[model samples]
Target: MTLFFAIVALAFAAVIFMQQPKFGKMPTGDRLERIKRSPNYKNGAFQNLSPTPSFTDGANFFTVMREFFFGGDPRIKPTDTIPHVETDLRNLPIDEQVLIWFGHSSYFMQVDGKRILVDPVLSGGASPLSFTTRSFAGTDAYAVSDLPPIDYLFITHDHWDHLDHETLKKLRSTVKAVICPLGVGAHLEYWDYDPAIIHEEDWNQTIALDDHFMAYTTPARHFSGRGFRRNQTLWTSYVLQTPSMRIFIGGDSGYDSHFAEIGRTFGGFDLAILENGQYNKSWRHIHTMPDEVLRAAADLKAKNVFPVHSSKFPLATHAWDEPLIKIVQAAEKTDLRLLTPMIGQVVHLDDSTQVFSHWWEGVN
Candidate 1:
């Protein structure tokens, strides 16, 4: 019994070590130091724009144990399977734009006829091992091969769900350029991505693609790390501005004053893709609740709200449908236009009259 227990302890330690964020040799750039020294570098937004105080490390061991061993309700059965959608890469037209949500923070966005993938994680599970973690309830929507040639890839942070090394390795050859926050390029570099093709930006700094589109690194109320050293790197949201429209992609943020600040700076957004799932009271300040999401939509003065980061992973104690239920109820009360697209459905932003078919019913 003593030997068996010792083996189990060592195994657990090995898992922790594998999950830690591996920082690479620091690159020489002024923006890197500027971001690290900034107060909002670790946390999203400027110091004055933060809604809550900083997080203090506590007894996360109990939290982890409770979640791992005794977390989800067994009454919830695994969702039914759905067919994956394949994108036509050979003859995609330049005028037509579409965005496909591949569950959680992963998305395949066709903007201005250009293909851009954000945080693509196609692994069987979101945890250290495939057998242990709860897989997403949504359909296995689309595989990497089905995707059109990716012109650009954006990473919000180094969290397992947001940045998977396996996904990066698969896409390294095909992707044109990778846009990321400071220090994130190190992970890509480690994965063998060419340094010249990686562009790192600080908060509020803009990267211009052309006269029609530009991307700005915005604020997110969250920390970044895969292991023990938290807040060593930066996390961020993104603002994609086109000639006629501006879109805000809220990577993963708790409710913060920065939403309003972003709105004030950009005037308003045509669409806001905000996180609306896997939230809990224990980390409420890092992940916005349903009510807070509504407030964020209002703060951004967005014409439409597309909720992401939920409907995929069972990372919290809430039921599979809880976030959607709360969001729909809250939207009715706040007069917000929420677009709930199916796993592979294409949403045309110019049209507001498009109907949202309830696709998660069979799966949920």
Candidate 2:
């Protein structure tokens, strides 16, 4: 028995030794100092919040272990597996404004002849290990190679799903500027992006793109970390305002007073894209449940709400389709306009004629 226990311990130690380091110190210099000292720099609001319930309960480990060793629930359906249709941007006139959902929090927004990619993740998996589970439905939609020249790349945080190192490396040269929350530039810089082109903003700080367009880093009730050290960096939601339109991108957040505050400051929004999936009672302070998402949209006084952060990875214990179903029901109860677009489908902001199809129905 002693010999067997010793062998098990050795195996565990070896696994730890073989694991790659998840984080490292970012480069510091005069440039970093200048950015840090800027008046726009605000301390990360969520970092100081009292700890919320754990997202994962103690039973999660055993359940996951059982699933790994022996297949558990197979109810989770695969993601959309249809090959993504690649359209020619050059042929289409650049004046049309369009938004395409690319699963999870990723979206391709074309506005005023400029193209922007938000939280783009094209990797096969979100975990550190390649062998782990992946998106229930395979992403057959456009890969990184299908993207045209990106005018701006916006990131809300450094979580694996939001900030993919491998994808960033591929986008380094093609993207003009990388816009992110404070300290996220460090990760991009480490990945070999031009430090000069990486712009970092703090909560409430606004970056003006032109007279017609601006991006503001808003507060999100969440924590950040690539590994064990939590809150070393900041996480944020974003408010993108243009002369003709206002859009609020809620990166990932728990229900908080900040949503109402944002509505007051912005005088409401035309649309609010919010995280609506991967929630648990254990981590209610960090991730909003489906019902909470509807409440947030109402707090923002948004005319339209689009649910995201689902249909990508199985990070929660709930059934894969629960988030969408709950969100739809909540929106109905709240009298909010819920826009549910298919993966890789385009949404025109100016037009309300398009139908919100239940795309996940057959897929899930």
Highest lDDT among the candidates is held by which one?
2
- Consecutive 10-residue window with the lowest summed lDDT within model 2: 40-49
Using all chains and alpha carbons, the TM-scores for the candidates as numbered come to 0.85, 0.85
Question: What lDDT tens digits, residue by residue, belong to model 1 across residues 1-364?
Answer: 9999999999898866675433233333754566557756545323324545443235265774586458755523346653344555435676776777777778877777677888888765666555755555445646666766788788988887888766777777899888887777877887788989987876888898766879999888887776646666678889988776788988888888999999999888988999998777667778889999989999999989999877666677777667777898888887778988766777777778888865656553
Q: Model 1: residues >4 Å from true position, as ranges?
A: 1-36, 39-68, 71-77, 82-91, 362-364
Each candidate structure's count of clashing pairs: 0, 5
Instruction: Output the number of the TM-score-best candidate.
Output: 1
Error of 1 at 109 (Å): 1.7
User: Native-vs-model 1 lDDT?
Assistant: 0.75
How far off is residue 312 in model 2, in Å?
Answer: 1.6
CA lDDT, every prediction? 0.75, 0.76
lDDT of 1 at 338: 93
Worst 10 residues of 1 by lDDT: 19-28
